[model samples]
Target: MLNIPLIGLKADQFRHPLDLEATNTLKQLPGLDLMVRQLLGQLGEQFFMLENLASSVQVGENQLPHLHQLLVEACKTLDLEVPQLYVRQHPMPNAYTFAMRGKQPFVVMHTSLIDLLTDEEVKAVIGHELGHLKCEHGVYLTLANLIVLAAGQISPLGTVLAQGLQAQMLEWLRCAEFTCDRAALLATQDPRVVASVLMKLAGGSPTLAPKLNVDAFLAQARAYDDLSSSELGQMLKQAQTAQLSHPVPVLRAREIDRWASSKDYESLLARSGSVCYDGETKTKGGWRNW
Candidate 1:
């Protein structure tokens, strides 16, 4: 693929508007930031780092070189430093990232997720996780993860407070996902690739993924939009998603389809230079080696 490196990309240049709004609202809540960072930050970071190092296979030049190449290319394209990448043994097809101040950021891809996606789709997934880092979503994201873990163990009085915080965190998380989808698109330079990843996640297994159609899935996304056109449908939609951390797969695919053709996406790429490289080896182009 002829990929472009967004030489001086900024998160705001492509960040979804809803993400910005939700993040600002999070920022306005007094002491939430300080409390999350000062209280839970270091412990959470250390714990996750140790857990990954112990249980996950870290990707690098000598190990899982292809995956490492994907990570390096995506980071170069997004103008961000490469973080550690780990493949963990799990049945769930999911990928997530962790970043916090004074800690080495990292991304984890479930083993099942690797089996479910094509190489390009895998790259898009990496890009999506990197989006959280690009936008500096570490603190709130760590808090959200920790909150879920701690919610079940809290005292009765603290449960109410935890629930309230969890609700807001989930709302922000869903909005944040849209922005990450955009990042995936930016990294892949193909909306179809990003949409395909969503489609597979929605209803696909290793066997089913090969048979799924991106066009049909996009049609289904449009249907979903129409389904929510009525007031009751809108309410039901809200209720269904209120407690969820990520946006619905179809909704994310729809957002990517819309944003990929937008002027903002085009303008961002227009200002950048393309690199001539296939998925494997890099070739010469109008890009600099970072």
Candidate 2:
């Protein structure tokens, strides 16, 4: 598939309004920037980097070159510098990234996630993680992960503080996910590819992924939206997601579906230059490949 490289693409160009608003809200909170960058930044980066180096296989031209290609291509599409990629052995299908300003950034994909997704879908997952980097979301996201990991060790008063911080961080995290999903869409240039990944994450295993239907899953997302029409349903929905880090899969899928057809999406693509082709004939539209 051919993709246009969104040269000089800015996060605000495709950032979800909710993400923007929530981020602004987070910025207003006292001392978060200092706590995240000065307090947790270096320690978190070192910890994750060391762990990956010890326990995970890094993807590069000489190691897992196919996955390396996907990462490089996705970065190119998003106008991002390629970050280190690692595949770790794990039962759960998941991928995450860690980055801090002035530090080497990296992404890790659980082996099971690669098993569950097609090559294209894997690229979309990579793109999703790259979204975090593109938005410079590393600082706060690192704090959020550190909080979850250290939750059981805090003192009572510290626990209260952690809880308060966690709640706000989780809300921002959820909204940030919406923006990342948009990044995934920008990288793939195909809504179905991004939505399929979410569907698979919702309820897919290796055995079930082939049988799962993207269109049906999107319809289910619509159904979920309809379910929130009533006041009670809306309250229930809010309660369900209040403590979650990512939005419910159906809601994420629904947001991607809506945004893909929006004039804004079209306009962004129309404005972007630089095309990447998969071993196809070069065209006048600035065809390039990684």
Candidate 3:
């Protein structure tokens, strides 16, 4: 299999505008980044490391070679360094990444996600998680997770801060997922493959995955766009997604579908051959400077 690498791929090339806007607003918050990194980043990293190490199966050449190959391929396709991959035995289909500026980063996938997706679909999931790293989302992401987990235990001032930041963080997180979905498309070079993964996640199981129809799911995505065109429908849509960390699957499917057909995606593919690999590696080691 000939792999056409997206050499020199940068997150900005595909980052959703909403993600950029939300991230810019979040960064304007005075000392919020420093405070979160100083107060909770390292501790959160340790907590997740311990949790995954105790319960998840780590992927390597010696174990789950096929999935490991998918990880490697996705990393190369996106021009990113490979992070550790762990498969946890959970019935729900989900995956997430954890990374820090100067600490080792990793992605965890629920075992059920693997069971529900084919090798190509699984590659899309891996690519999506790698997107989080490529964009350096880990710092604030960890802080968001920590805030949600420890909101009650925080001091009154801290609670107020968390309350204010949580909505913004959640909004950013949702937009970030859109950017990652584009990453998945870049890695697979197949929009339907990415859309199928979303469709499956919306409602898929090991038994039903094979029977599902990607075309129908995509049509449904379009239908959703039509339904949400009215003012009342738009408000309902906002209410449906305001509290969620990821955009609804149909919305994601529609977004990817539009991007896949846009001139931007076409231009990107045409330019892929000209962009040579820079041979830079993304690895974290020193904690003192962080």
Candidate 4:
């Protein structure tokens, strides 16, 4: 894996504009931020951490060594603090992150997900999760998780607040995923790797993964983008994703394709410094001037 070190990586460098707008909207809510942290942050983090410790396999140099190397290399490329990684047994292929202040943050990947993706693709998944921590999406992400989990028990007054905030938070979360997809692209330094991961997630199983064609899947994404040209089609598109936690897979593929060809992506890559990976030193020193 090529380590393209972004010496002073900041969230804004890769943050999706929609994510910025939605985050600003959430911040505008009076007392919402403080209320979320004080009310749910502490207990929610503890619950997730304990659950993972009991149910997941933690990765380290001595365990899943190759996967551990990917995580270390990606963190170095993005200039992020390496968080704990855990692989949990599950049939579904997926990954997620839970982070909080004053506590150890961690990323969890399903066993099936690792089974499906290659080493570079796995690194992209790891980078995508790290983007959440880099962007501080956890506070709101936890709140959204809480709302979904407790929606049935929330009081009428709490329901009113949740109803209003849920829509906004869901939208923000979807946008946040876009930013993380970009992070995946940066980590892998290959747009095709990011798009391939999304494509596989859309429908590829262990049986069909080897037969799937990435070029054909990308063409399908273009067709999907074309479908939104009409007004009714646009509405249909919005309706299809209205309640989704992440944007539909084709939309994500399309976004990465566009960004990969954009000047912004080109400039960022041009400005980055490359680190050669050897057995003795995991990464060589390099820094971005601006």
lDDT of 4 by residue, 1-290 (tens): 77667766667778899998876665676775777877777887889889988999999999999889999888888878788999999999999997766367889999999888889999999999988878878876765666555763677777777676677777888999999999998889898999889999999888887778889999999999888979999999888898889999988999999999998888777766543345332333543212
Better candidate by lDDT, 1 or 4: 1
TM-score for all predictions? Answer: 0.85, 0.85, 0.85, 0.86
- lDDT per residue (tens digit) for residues 164-231 in model 2: 77787788889899999999999899999999999999999999999999999999999999999899
How does candidate 1 fare on TM-score?
0.85
RMSD of 1: 6.2
Backbone clashes in each candidate structure, one number apiece? 0, 0, 0, 0
Which clashing pairs does model 3 show?
A: none
Q: For candidate 3, which ten residues in a row score worst on lDDT?
A: 281-290
Residue 254, model 2, lDDT: 96
Error of 2 at 184 (Å): 0.6
After aligning candidate 3 to the native by TM-score, how far in Å is the CA of 13 from where it should be? 1.1
Mind sharing the TM-score for model 4?
Answer: 0.86
Against the reference, the lDDT scores of all candidates come to: 0.85, 0.85, 0.83, 0.83
Worst 10 residues of 1 by lDDT: 281-290
What lDDT does candidate 2 reach at residue 79? 79
Residue 58 deviation, candidate 4, in Å? 0.4
Q: What is the C-alpha RMSD of each candidate to the true structure, in Å?
A: 6.2, 6.1, 5.1, 5.8
- Candidate 4, residue 222: Cα displacement in angstroms equals 0.5
What RMSD does model 3 have?
A: 5.1
The digit string of per-residue lDDT tens for model 3 on 213-253 reads 99999999999999999999999999888889889999999
Best model number under TM-score: 4
